[model samples]
Structure formats: C-alpha cells, structure tokens
Target chain A: MSAQPAAVPHLEIDGVSKRFGETEVLRDVSITVPRGTFLALLGPSGCGKSTLLKIIAGLETQTGGHVRLDGEALDGMPAYRRDIGVVFQSYALFPHMSVKENVRFGLDMRRLDKAESAARVDEALELVKLGGYGSRMPSELSGGQQQRVAIARSLAIRPRLLLLDEPLSNLDAVLRKSVRVDIRELHDRVGTTTVMVTHDQEEAMSMADQVAVMAEGRVLQMGTPEAIYERPATRFVGGFVGSPPASLMKLSRRFEGGWRFGEIEWQMEPALARRLDAIRRIEVTIGLRPERMRLVEAGTEGALAAELRSSEYLGGERLLHAAVGQERIAALVGGHLSGLPKPGEPVHLLPDADAVMLFDAENGERLDP
Target chain B: MRSSTPLLFLLPAVALSAVVFLAPFAWLIYASFKTQGAGSLLMADGLTVKNYARLVADSYFAAAFVRTIGLSALTTLLTLVVGLPVARLIATGSGRAKGLLLALMLVPLVCGALLPSLGMIHLLGPLGVVNGTLKLLGLTTSSIKFLGTTGGVVLGLVQAFLPLMVLPLVNTLSRLPRDVEHAASSLGASPLRVWRRVILPLAMPGIVAGAVLVFSAAFTAFVTPQVLGQGKIATFGTVAYQQAALVLDWPFASTLAVVVLVAIGLALILSAQFDRLLRRRRLAA
Candidate 1:
C-alpha cells in the first residue's frame, strides 16, 4: 500500500546549480517532476544532463538551491537516506554477490525478514526476467543480464523515484532496442516517478513521456517528444533531435510574398509568411526536416534545381543526399522505390511549407512561426 | 603462435629449475640418509636413519624448532592485525595522504635488518630512551627490561617485515572496484557493513600473501633475534648456526637445515591453499 500522498510535488528541483572549480557545469537548473511520470533529460555529451541527475539522486550535491521529494527537503541528505533507486551506466553490481544476493541487498539493508527479502528478490528478478539466474555470479552473466540484475537490485527496495543514467548505452544496438522497451514497461508497471539521463535522442523520444533538452549546462527546452521534435525552440534542439539533422539553409524574403534562397523562390504558408515578415528581406536560416524535402521532376516551376549526391539503402528507407546550389541537403525516400537518380544527375528539390522552420541567422533563435 | 613463443622463452627457466632446485633437493634427501660420524658423508657406510634420530633426541634442537614456529605464527598474526588497517587507509585515503603514508611505511624497509635492530635495542635497553621517557612521565620508578625476551625479538621482526605485509595488501585493495563500495552505500548499507561485506572479502588474497611472506621471513630471521633476544631466545636458524659454526657439527646442522626447509615448505603449501580459496570466492562473488 502507498503511504499518504504528501502535499508537496513528488519531486521538486529548485534553482539547482553546480560548478567544478572554474568550470560552470550546471546553472540554476530546476524542474518539477510529477508523480509516476517518466522524464528523460536528453542532451549531447558534456551538457550537464547526467550532472543534474546525480544532483537529484543526492550522489552529487548542488552548489546552490535544494531538491525535495514528497514534501521533504533533500539537501544534506545522503543518497541512501533519500530512498531513491539508481541504475548507473556501468551497472555497478557487487562482484562478490550472486544475482539473488545482489537483488536482496537493499532489502537486507532495510532489515527486512529473511523470508520477506527472499520473496521480494524473487519478484524483482522476475520483473527483470532474470528469475532463473539467482545463483549465477555477476561476471558470469552477459552484459545485458548484469544490467538486469542491477535493475532488479534497485527495484527490490520499491523506491519511490528511480534515477537511471544512460542505462542502455552499454548494450549493443539490438539489445538496446529491446532493453529500451523493457525499461519503459518497467516504469509503467511500477508507476514510480522516474528521471533518466541520456545523450541518445531516439532513446529519449521512444522511452520518455516528456523530454527535457539540455545544452551548455542549461535546459534549453522541456516538453513532450512531439513538441521537442516538431517545434524545437532553439537551433541546437532542431539540429540535435533528428537523424540526418534538420537541414539548415540561408534564405531571404522575395518581394512577392515568398522566400528566396539561391535561384529558387517559393510562396510560404500564411502563418509562416507573417512570422518571416518581421525580418523581411534580411537573410535567415531555414530548417527543413529530411522527411519534409522531396525529389520532384526538374523544371517544376517553384522547386529548386538540385543534383543527386549520394544514397544509402537502410532496409526500409533510403536516405538520399542532394545539393541545391552550394547547400547539401538530404531526403528520406521509401527503400522499395526503384527509379532512383544516379549521382550528379539534375533533380528538383521541393520543401513542404508547413514543415519549414525559420531561425534568425545572427543568434539561431527560432522565429515566432 | 603468439602463445607458443612465450612458452618457448619459458623453457630455459623450467630447465634451470629442474637442474638447480629439484636436483639439489634430491641430493639433500640422499645425503640425509648417509652415515656421517667416522668419515666423510660422501663415502656412506650404508644408508641410515641416524641423523634423523639424533635430531629428535636433541632437546636444544627441539626447543629451537618450537620457538621458531611459535614466533613465526605470532609475528604473522600481529603483522596482519597492524597491517590491514594501515593498508586500507593507504588504499582509500586521499592521494597526497596515501603517498605520505606509503613513504613513512618504507622507512623501516630502507633501514633494513641490522640498523633497525640496533635502534630497537637502544630504545628497549635498561637505560634506553624509552625507559628515560617513561621515568619522565612518572609511569614507572625504575627501567623496564625488554631485551632477552621473545617480545623484543618479535617486535624487531615485525618492524623489519611490516612493509612486506602492507605493500601487497595495498596493491590489491587499491585495485578493488570502487563502484562496489558506492553501490553498497547507495543501498543504505553503513560504512562498516560495506567494509565487512565488500572490502575484506575482496582483499583476502593480498592478506594471505602478506601473511605467508611475513611468517616465512620471521621464521628464518637471525640477525634481529640475535641482537634483540640477547642470546636467551633460541630459534631454529640460531641453533643451526651454533651447530655449523660454534660446535663444528656439519651433519647435525644439515639435519636442522632440512627441518627448516620442511617447515617452510608446509607453511607455503597451506598459504597457497588459502589463496586459492580466496580467489575462488572472489570469482563467485
């Protein structure tokens, strides 16, 4: 049974800041995590995402401000006292303990009776689908199995908040996909407030209910994955979140209520047109998702003339690379489509107006489209 | 191909071991059975058990054997008790502090056997600095006698071999996975519990190796016991010295040497078994 629900937010990070000597690692970062939600702190490496996770877990103390869980201030509280479960990137399972003993460690630390601890250990192992491996040593198991033992060990305590730091990074590509789904399922089954730190954008988009994009030791944007991918607030987010990265090109306004780049000119959607009006003829960067660019027949009037550069056949989808003037761009095409243009062949590249994203060239901030 | 190249290089070492160690040990066993009173042992008057019987009948030899074993056992135990905490501190302490402690531990090793024994005698003698300090502190009225006792010999032996016990332990403990300790702490285990459940079990191999080295060194120790024991406490090595040099009984001394060899061989075998057990447990964990 759950304890009485406290009045405070399930997890509240207030004005958290951290500095390692002269280097400012995290600056006044804060977020409120609702109970039973899976939140992913997604960023590039050296972006302070992992540092913030450690701060929330009490493994690393903040230089300023505080963290609270269930109405209790967590400042000065050691990691164990905070009653949070953590799965590190390295797994960190005790090499001297069997899978069973490792899972039961937290329960034993809580002074649970032997019978109760054994049952919980069994349940935890079953939760991670490692029930038959109770007597095996950590080193004897495969990497993924060792990771499962680590997860089971953390879950044995039934912690209220689970903190995971790139928990699937150590797995191979195939294992990472399956383990990612397992982690999401585990989160759903426990219904515990969870925060995961990861540099893998797809992992965050697939596993997290909400994604917090971080860069340069600060949170640049935080929203659902749809918001993060579709309407990224900063150029960094737009460039970072998508595969083949949203292509950015310099564009200027034409006199006839459309945008121009190189030899191409096209009418913009009215909503996007008004947003570009503020900057009028001044040059700006336009972001087009790979899926939003298409190859049309040459001399299609508004479309830009381009030359095919390269193509990669990726099982279900073919990634086509092309050049429009001096700007290199990519388009994702169906893999089964056979009439592909060869390298150096002229083609027409057209942009989907609704999917176009505009940013100020000087600062790379998203324009208000 | 790569593995066999190293094996070929190891052949010389194996051949040398067969020629040097095994051949001599076989010859010693043969010599132990030869008759030796009337003439040279090279011309044996038939193989006999007389040397072994003489060794058993000698009371002084028996006392020395028991004393050597007891002293070695005590020294090993004391070294373990003292060295384990120091080694753990060296392994886990801050970088500068660990370096300083390591340097301090090496001082006795640099001083070696003779100088440190002389230093100990000066400190433990009747009118020595220790007695003078005790007198100044009003802890005693007269000097306390420490020389000519087993305690003095043990103190000397421990000081000489302390680094042997600490270094191996520090090496192994320092290499232990630090993540294991953090995992235990994050699981709500206390610091003492973490040490008991994680650190000590992982460090058992180094502790066993240290114990064996300390025991063997103490068993064969001559100079420190000679200086500090003041001719009162007899050990197997001292008895062998008396037979070979002072008494001029080469056959009897050789027999005593054989006994020392057997005792040391047994101790090494037992220590090896302990090391294996520790290794297996580490792997199981």
Candidate 2:
C-alpha cells in the first residue's frame, strides 16, 4: 500500500544539513516517511544518503535541522534514547556475544524479566528464521546468516524506527535476492517505519514502496518506485534508476524541423517543436532507455547511425553496445533478431518518438513536455 | 628440506642467544642452588638447598613476596583504570590529536625506567613539586611522606609501565569497530551499558595482555621501586637488589632472582592459558 502524506508522519527529517568542516555532506535534505512505509534512500557513494540515514537514527547530529519521531522532536537525544534500531552494512553483530545474548541486549537494558526476554529473543529469531541458533557466537554464522541475526537483534528491541545501512551489500548475489525478499516480507509483517540506504537501484526499485533518489548531497526525486522510474525529475535520476541505464546525449544543432546531433537527426512534432521554440535553448540533453530504442539496418531512414562496439548475450535478449558520435548507447534487442552486427561494424538505432525525454543541458533538470 | 631450511637459517640466531643469554640463565639457576663458605664470596663445591630453604623459612622474605605481589597487582589495576580511557582516546581520535597522544604516550617508554622514575621523584617526593605546590597553596602545614611508601612505589611503577597497558589496549581498541558500540546504543544500551556489554567484553584480550605485561614489569622492576621506595618500602625487587648488589650474598640473591623469574614465567603461562581458553571457540568456529 502506498503511504499518503496526509497521514501522521512516523519519522520526519526536516531540513537536516550536516557538514564535516567545510565539506557539506548533506545540504538541507528533508524527507517524511509515513508509518509502516518501507523507504529506500538510494544513491551512489558519497551522495549523503547514508549520512541522512545516520542523522535520522541519531548516530550523527545534524549541524542544522530537526528530526522528529512521532511528532516528538529528537534533538539532543542520544542514540540509545532515540529508540531507533540500526542494522549496519557490516551487520555490527557483537562478535563476543552469542546470538541470544546479542538479541537480548536491548531487553537486558530494559531490565525485562528472564522469561519475557527469552520469549522475545525466540520471536525475533523465528522472524529471521534463525530459531535454533541461540547459543552460537556471531563468528559462527555465515554472512547471510549473520545479516539475519543482525536483523533479528534489531527487531528484538521492537524499536520505534528501523534504519538499515546497505543491509544486503555484503551478501552474495544469490543471497542478496533472497535476503532482500526476506527483509521486504519482514518489513511488511513488522509494519514499522523502515528506511534503508543502498547504492543498488534494483534493490530500491524492487523492495521499497517509496524511493528517494539522491545525488551530490541532495534528494533529486522522492516518490513511489513507479513514479521515480517512469518520471525522474533530473537527468542524474534518469540515468541512475534504470538497468542497462538510459543513454543520455546532449543535442545542440537545430535543422529545418528537428534537432541535429552530429550525423543523427530527431524530427520533432509540430507541438513539441513549438515547446522547444518557446524555451529557445540552443543545446538540450535527451535520454532514451535501452529497451525503447531498436537496432535497424545501417543507413535506414530517420535512424541514428552508430558504430557497434560490443554485444552481450542475456539468455532471451542480447544487449547491443553502440556509439553514436562520442556518446555510448545500448539497445536491448531480442536474441532472435534477424540482423546483428559484429564489433566495429556500422549500425542504426531507431528510437521510439514518445519515449524520449528532454532535459536542460546546463542544469541537467528535465524540461516539461 | 624446504621447511627445515627456514629452521636452518634460524640456527645462528638461536645459537647466539643460547650462548649469550641461556648460558648465563643456566648459571643463575645453578648458582641459586649453591652457597658460599663463611667469610668467603666464592661459591662452595657441594650444592645445597639452604638458599631456597632460607627463602621459604623466612617470614621477612614471605612478607616481601606478598608485598611485591600486592604492589604489582595494584600497579596493574591502576594502569588499566587510567590507561583504558587514554587508549580509547588514542584509538578513536584522528589526525593531529591521535599523533600527539601517541607521541606523549611513547615519551616515557623511550625515556626508560630510570629516567621516568627519577622524574616521578620530583613529582611525588615529600619536598618535591607536589609538596611544594601543596605548601604554596596552604593545603598542608607539613610535607606528606610520599617517598619510601607503598603508594609512592606503586605510583612510580604505574607511571613507568602505563604504556604497556595502553599499547595493547590501543591495538585492540583500534581494531574494535565503532559500529559495535553504535549497534549496542541503537539496541537501547546507554553509554555505560555499551561499555559493559560490548566494549569491555571485546577488550578482554587487551585487558589480559596489558595486565600480564604490567604485572610482570612491576614484579621484577628494580630501578623504579628502589629509587622511589628509598629503602623503607621493601618490595621483592628492592630486596633482591639489596641482597645481590649491597649484601653481596650472590647465591641468596640468585635464589631470590630465580623466584622472581619463576613467578613471572608462571604469570605468562597463566595468561597464555587464559588466551587459549578464549580462543578455543573462535578457532573451532
């Protein structure tokens, strides 16, 4: 279910800005995660997504801004008092502690009765499917198992908000998929406000109901996964969110009734031409997803000529890597296609007219159609 | 042959150490069993257990042994209590602060036992800087008896060997991930609870290592105890020094030295056993 903003915000990170000396790590970033929403702060390294997560978890203090949990301002609250559970990228399981002890740590801090604590530990471990691993030390578990134990440990606390920092990054590819599913299912069952920071686009798209795409210390876009994928607000978001990502090329020259990029020409519709004319931009960037463009025979009419560089087989589909001038673009063509060019051969790409996105060349912001 | 080649290469060093070090140690053990004829410094022909018998029989030596053990234990504990925070600061601090703290910690270590012990004299002496400051501040009308006291000797020993505790602690604490503490905190552990549950448990190896090192150092320490004790506080080391160098009863002194060496060796073995026990599960895992 989609989280509506009209509902009371379970976690509100308002204008949180963090600076380490002169370097601004997070610049006035803000996000409101509604109750029971699984939100992903998706970005590459040094994008301030992890920093924002830390600020919310109270592991770090924001140089400026207020973070409120259930409308109560969490300013000056130590991480212990924040009642937030953080599952670190490394898992951060106490190596000296047994799985049971690690899970019971928060309960022990609460001074819960032995029977109650033991029951809680059992419940948490069962949730993570590690029911019989109580007496084992953290060092005894596999990476995936350790990750689950970390999740179990955090869940044992029944924390108000749960923050996961790149939770599945350490796991193998196969384990990552399974663990990702487990985490999503756990979140659904737990129904706690969850925020996961990850550089993985697919992880965000698949697991999160809401995804906030971040870049260069700023939130570029925040919406449902579909909205983020279908309509990225900036060129950065457009290039970042897709698999075999969208090919972006800057087009400058304007011909008779279309835009010209070196030897390639994109004929504009009458309505689109009027919009472009109104903006009066000499240079504009265009984005095209790999699946939206088809590989045609060289010298085809209205097709952009490209030099085929490589091809990768992907079972039912093959990816064609081609270069149009200096810009490299890929086409996800069917493996059963009739014609496929060898590396270094000339090819033509025919793009779907309606799927093309226009962006401002200077700022990389998407221009409205 | 290839594996044995490395051992063959190690032969020279082993042989040199055996000749230079083990030979003297063997003689020391042998001498501990011999005794001198009356009014003579030269060792007598037949071996006797009188030296060890004297050590076991004398209540004075027993008291000295107990006092020495107590002082060493006290020094070990004091250094641990004081060094834990300093080691943490060095481990967690960055850039200039870390470098500065490390350099400060190393200064006394490089200065050696005698120099720092001398420095401690000025700091803890009755008419020294502390007493002078106290007198100036009108805190006391008379000088406190810091010199030739158990407290004075222990203070000197702790000051001399705190780096022993801190170095191992820093090595361990630095390797300890900050995330572990954060996880504890995030799991509803207060700062104190985090220390008790996570930090102290993880730092056990460092604590044991530092304890052993500081204990061994203080147990056999001569210069600091002798200088700071000033002949009034009779520790095992001070008594050993008095017997060997001042009393000139080489055989009796050698027996005392052997006792110290045995005690230190036992401590090492005990600590090694502790380490093995801690590591058994880890190795199996």
Candidate 2 C-alpha lDDT tens digits along B24-123: 9999999999998788889989999999999989999999999999999999999999999999999999999999999999998898789998889989
Off by over 4 Å in 2: A1-7, A255-257, A268-279, A297-302, B1-9, B136-138, B280-285
Question: Which candidate wins on lDDT?
Answer: 2
DockQ numbers for every candidate? 0.46, 0.65
Taking every candidate in turn, the Cα RMSD to the unseen true structure, in Å, is: 4.3, 2.2
Native contacts present in each candidate (fraction): 0.56, 0.72
Best by DockQ: 2
Q: Residue A54: error of model 2 in Å? A: 1.3
Candidate 2 lDDT over residue span A1-369, tens digit each:
456457557788889899999999998888988888899999999999988888888889999999998789998899888888899999999897788888998899889999999999999999999999988988888999998899988988899888999998999999899889999999999987899999999999999999999988889899999998888899999999989899998887565656767666655445556666777788888888898888776565557778899999998899999987778888899988765789998888887666677789999998974
lDDT of 2 at A151: 90
Stretches of candidate 1 off by over 4 Å are A1-7, A249-273, A279-283, A299-304, A324-326, A360-363, B1-60, B89-112, B115-149, B227-232, B275-285
- lDDT scores for all predictions? 0.84, 0.89
What are the interface RMSDs of all the models?
2.0, 2.3
